[model samples]
Target: MKQYELNTIPDEGYRQALASLLYQLADDDFILAYRGSEWLGLAPHIEEDVAFSSINQDTMGHASMIYELLASLGEGTEDELAHGRPPEERRNAIILEEVNGPGDYLIEPRYDWAFAVVRHYFYTVAKKVRMDSLKQSSYGPLAEAAVKINTELYYHLLHWQTWFTQLMNAGGEAKQRMEDAVSRVCDDFLGVLTLGPDGESMSRYGLIEEEAILASRWTEALKKPFDSTGVQHPPVIRSLRGDGRKGEHTGDLTDALHTLSEVYRLEASGTW
Candidate 1:
């Protein structure tokens, strides 16, 4: 297959498939980064709070870079793509868009640190799997983007893995919390691994690997860590909330979009 730069994509079908994949990539990081930003000043401790913020910033920057790539493909301006779309148009996995927990982030926030650790670790593992595959994408720009994104993912995986393992081994309440968090995350984690309805076309076009392959890689990567933490890996992963790739989303995404897009919406015509 011939590699395609943004302007050199020859077939309309290929262009659409590339756009779809880019949306999935851009929206996943964008929503998750927003969720991460909400945890600012709310982490259990100061050092973690700072470290976590840095990760969030990096994730958001990754999202911005993807959005810019989309813009070059004529999707829209980066700001418009990131903020102008409604929840139904988002392509992020439903699991990523879910709220951190009950209660508002600004008031009476009851954010669960255990849940955060488990979710981040699991999601980062999946992201790494996808990025590794994307490094060989037929789309030249995306392959380049994936290489850059993969560099930061190392720290993301390490940071979350450390938190996940430590909390799981702490015993007593911490252990119980971490285990419960693992179960909760498992309920929706399959959505994170899914590549949506166009997954086959994406694979056929060499945009990325098949969903099953990516899922297998993610599971293999997580096994040692899960075993060490005494957490049982779920035999089957389910997308209980619905697939975000197909544009089916939950209320969590609605709330998140409203917050993240607020500034952009306030002055849509004005420069940021």
Candidate 2:
């Protein structure tokens, strides 16, 4: 398979598809990392606060790396790509951009731990599947990024999986909360499973595998945890209309970007 270097990509169609894919990848991590950052000092305990902070930093770094790749492709400077995009231009999954819970991150945040664990766990598994396939991507930079990302993902997946399993087996209100979280996650989870409108071209160009194949892998990967914890597979809602890939987003994303970009917006001309 031919590996496409920065300028070696074959045609206009391939560039557009690859750029779309890059935006999706970058925006997903960028938005979710921002969400994760909200847990700082608010995690269940001090240890988790520290550990979760580290994880959020790593995730945001990954987003930055991808933004640089996009910059190489002439999209914009990495800062602009990361901080300048509007809600409609963001390509993250709808689930990733949703609020961590209700209320503000500051001043009496009634965030739900169950939702955080479930969302991160499920998203991590899906990301692992995607990254695994991306390791073989024909786009050299993306494949390279996938390889580097898998290192942190190893710890990330372990962390979330442990939280997920332990919570589900707690067998009380904890278990019930986790199950409810699973249902809510499943509602928009499909957003992460598909590659959006560019899915066909992405596969054709060998950027990554098709959505069906990736989704199948995600399902299979979750079987072990589900089986061990005796949690049945929650039905994934396929009718979700707020698919973020197509720029369909709720006010959640608007509010998130507002907060996230506040500092960057203050100094748009500054470097990252």
TM-score of 2: 0.96
Clashing pairs in 2: none
List model 2 lDDT by residue over 1-272, tens digit each.
Answer: 88898778899999999999999999999999999998888899999999999999999999999999999999999999988989999999999988888676446657899999999998899999989999999999899999999999999999999999999999999999998998888888889988999999999999999999999999988988898879886356462657888999988889888888898999998887
Q: Name the best candidate (by TM-score).
A: 2
User: lDDT scores for all predictions?
Assistant: 0.87, 0.90
Instruction: For residues 1-272, write the lDDT of model 1, one tens digit per residue.
Output: 67888778879988888889989998999999988888999999999999999999999999999999899988899989999998888999887887887576546557888888888888899999999999999999999999999999999999998998888888999999888888788888887888888888899999999999999999899888878877776435777877889899988888888887788988998643
Candidate no. 1 TM-score: 0.95
* lDDT for residue 36 in candidate 2, whole number 0-100: 93
